[model samples]
Target: MASHVVDDTALAGFRTGLAGDAITPGDAAYDEARTLFNAMIDRRPAVIAQCETARDVAEAIRFGRENGLEIAVRGGGHGVAGTALNDGGLVIDLRRMRAATVDPRARTVRVGGGATMSRLDRATEPYGLATTGGRVSTTGVGGFVLGGGAGWLDRKFGPACDNLLSVELVTADGDTVRASEDENPELFWALHGGGGNFGVATSFTLRLHPLPVVTAALLLWPPDMGLDVVRAYRDFLEAAPDEVGGGVIYMTAPPEEFVPEDMVGKLACGVLVTYAGEMQEMRDVAEPVLGLDPDAEMATECSYADLQCMFDDPPGYRNYWSAEYLGSFPDPAVERFCARAADLIVPSPSQHVLFPQGGAVARGPAEYPIPWRRAPWVVHPFGLWEDPADDDRGRRWAREARADVEPWSMGAVYLNFIGREGEDRLVAGFGPDNHRRLAEVKARYDPENVFHLNHNIAPARGRAG
Candidate 1:
């Protein structure tokens, strides 16, 4: 069936006064206008309003309501589920609102919702500083923080949401409000890991941290060493200091300058490790795993910003992501992880990843909106395919792999890893109590549930009038 298109003639009177670009379906720039980071998701909204200011967002909300159109708010469009796009809806694009104000002495940064990781990292790196951010430099800070971002320094620091000091958001009713622990405390709590249920966040006042000089690198192990590698990793992480962070992925090794071409496309285990502390302590920490195989190369010191980008696969790749938290990595689960990975590799560049948890993630869980505070690790099946024909194949491999780990799971999923298939995962992301509170906040600020585009949280059904 052909999709509905809201006529440009209908919006003609509305577009002229706004400070941002509004593209309609037939516009020449419409194709690029609707593009996002993930290639697997393809949807075109009826109108794309590339908003440059909070006022533009408010105007977009007003327009969508008056026109009876659904709304999708795009920050960095790095969401695994492509929540940034919509079919037959209106998109409020905040990409142009990229300004950032860093207060280094105060150890804080007030960043626009549209700011990218590269933008944030570059702005703070000069002072040897950083905030919790995604591994990819391209990830939008807004979406990353809102969904409880875990990055290279997450073990040393906490999740991004934990560092957030305040947020400026535009409500579903075209009203702007500032949320923080001391101010709108309820809304602030909900904003921490609440997804986009409450509103379109315009900016964030996030706490920053000092970056320690560190050794970080990808330790590649042959496919035959998967068991030895997973075992060594689990053991090393147990005694590792908070300054150390790592995640292991079963992947097809790349034929890069650092990787031997003879091993190109060879199925192997790649451990992305980052150690932030004194160089001597870093060497001692890595010695055990480096001793496992003489082929395990020693890591080199790199800046925190560079280290974060080291493992993030490039954007525009066709991919599917499914994840669950693990209370512990038992012997059987390790065997299952490696065994199932061998069978689930769909095509080129797919990775079965196991990210270390605990450390700062488990600290002060009572202060954040995230659930699954006790989980010690996260297991994600990242299905990547270069062939469009292999879409279904890639999806099935990810699903079957997830099934393999279901029994070992901690019954919680990361909000960022969720997409359209995760509508129910939203409730699972936050616990029933937090979800209920978020729904109440939704009812108070947006009684009609105007922001329904995200992993939707329907209003508390509202109070009895």
Candidate 2:
């Protein structure tokens, strides 16, 4: 349990063998390297290995284990739990490995562990192809996909993990491995939603779909209309086709050119719909919601890549987020969901969101550890605000949102949508049976739980102890 005091000799040796720089606390860019998307997390690792290749990742893991340093693997550093960092430890920083290679002919993309959604999207845009990705462009592909990614395209293409073809990983023993349906099959199954628990994913090869253009519609109204709007949106999504996606959100309206002046910076209720089709087809599919007479509306066809960046949530804010999956969103659930919106910190960048999940997301491989996929609705309380003074209020609001939906809750949750809740929630992320299977896989790949910083799955006792 003692901490490792990395000596000059060991540090120098690690630096000599790395293809990229090994940054230390004294380094000029150390602060920037340690910075995460959430302003609330602040940890100082003894060494940060900015890996540039799979080999680099392996070497970094070896160095960390040999030096007795607690290892933290960091990609885009967007995880709200701050597991991407560890105090007085070693960090395998993959931010420099941001290459995304697209094979247009094969309809696949090989993205580096550190590559963000922006990199992945832009790489495939020219090919008129895309896969399920995080809603924010800045999210790291490694964390998002491994954690079971959800996005605007999820209803059509399914969760990101469903599209994942393979992963190149570096295990706890500093060995390079490949996981796929055909190779290391059990490990591949675990990687579906087991997250960074097994090892550091050096790169991911994911299946992409042809999506030249996507139609997006944003219809907004005052906060007072939340109840009626939420109910209508729920009813509409119940029968919506797989091609339809998006969510109902309550947030402070931004001062975009399309937003009315009165709505900007005020609490507003809105529905964003994305369709994997032409504008006319989307208009026809969305006619029911369109008839609601929104105070402000913006509907158009845009590049899938461009549309991915439309709702980029700005970082550098204090963040606390939580999610609850629901088997159904009845009228009472809708009322409770809308009522919780009142607790959200208005005039801030927080969002009270309800995402529909019954399309391809629900239809994805049922065998994967992600039990939350079977749910039809997901209530996501994304709390982001500038003032630290509102931290308590933000946390309470997110908790209340989940509590209000407990009556209709499915118990299973999406790990990526939440911060560190506790062991029960972690176990619930994967159902009991899936968790046991994932733990066995963890036993094989990372018995010592070296990659324990994520939504961790402790290895089976016989293997680890």
Candidate 3:
């Protein structure tokens, strides 16, 4: 990890690390091992240290520090801009560290930072328990919580960061500390929405709730109904119950049995709504949304776990994401959003989704330094594709789609949804108080900035930076 020009001997030391496998630039498995979810990011790191335990992470950090090499910590390998895997750096991969332990009675669960949303959901759903998380099943715990996770249950519980009770992290100086409300309270606060600027989180103790059952619908509608659908969505969000969640997605129709054959490749909108509460209440709250469009797939109730995997993206497809906070939906701004969808027309018909953000998410732990504290809704534009050649179009559309809504946005973006745009936006993620606090905590735990590849926030008096 020295100057993007590492030699064989240097990578050899990392290859022999304990409890996991390592991949170098020339190894047969390098291509499969190093790639992340977002194809837009293409950095070639000198070494990939796939770590299985916290000790492995500590060792990699120390090794990189002593050898004067750049370091990157990869958990789920889904970083949009690929911050999880840095070029020419020693990557501390934690994919093998996934382990989840649940205590149903106590309503708490301890999960590895390497775990994905689906992994966590499966482990907890049997006990009828759930946690705040992103809508997509493959989203990683590390990035989502560090940046303030938003999900359907956020209205009832809180952001994924808010549900975080504690974290076990390996600091830059190789110190393993448990951060909670009382134990290293400062570090705990910083980790609330600090991204991975301070350290590599090994495991997290999270709060959970009863997810008794789910009543949901993926209402598909015509392309021209985009404006009407957006207006209807705003009204629903304005007064929707805390138990109700999910977002309205405007995308191009796919050629599938569920979709109308005649509408393939045409722009369309679908409200993928979900609610977990008394069945009657869920139906009452969702009825208005169902009436927005002329035709729908029909509303039905199902198991919570079934709902969790509803929007799964194939493992190998490329994904690009961007999000922004809307101040408010005054006088049918939903219609405006629909108008844009109708105009530019996203690159792929199957890749766009927008959802509201206020609800319980707005009320983060009073002291937490989360961005977008009070936005009514945050719009996320995703570009998904299978054809490798369509990569440029996906990237171009994702950026341009976000840009189209710049006027309505509050200049605030979700950290998890952000790419490798740099640290300025990381600062924007958690305003100055949280950012400054995170920097101080980073100084105390990782003065040299060993964990610098993430949405990094350097220590107050860090290395020459």
lDDT of each: 0.81, 0.92, 0.76
Top model number, lDDT: 2
Residue 150, candidate 2: Cα error in Å is 1.0
**TM-score for candidate 2:** 0.98
lDDT of 2 at 389: 92
Of candidates 2 and 1, the better by lDDT: 2
Give candidate 2 regions above 4 Å deviation.
Answer: 1-3
TM-score of each: 0.95, 0.98, 0.91
RMSD of each: 2.0, 1.1, 2.7
Query: What tens-digit string does per-residue lDDT give for candidate 2 at 1-465?
Result: 445789899899999999998999989999999999999998889999999988889999999989899999999999999999989999999998989999999999999999999999999999999999998888999999999898999999999999999999999998899999999999999989889998999999999999999999999999889888888888888889999999999988888888999889898999999999899999998888888989999998998888888888887999999999998889899889888888889788899999999889888899999999999999999999999899899999999999999999989999999998999999999999999999888888888888998898999889652
Worst 10 residues of 2 by lDDT: 1-10
Error of 2 at 297 (Å): 1.0
Question: Candidate 1 — what's its lDDT?
Answer: 0.81
The true-versus-predicted C-alpha distance at residue 347 of model 1, in Å, is 5.3
- Writing each residue's lDDT as its tens digit, candidate 3 over 32-60 gives 77878766567787777878889888888
Task: Rate residue 84 of model 3 by lDDT.
Answer: 80
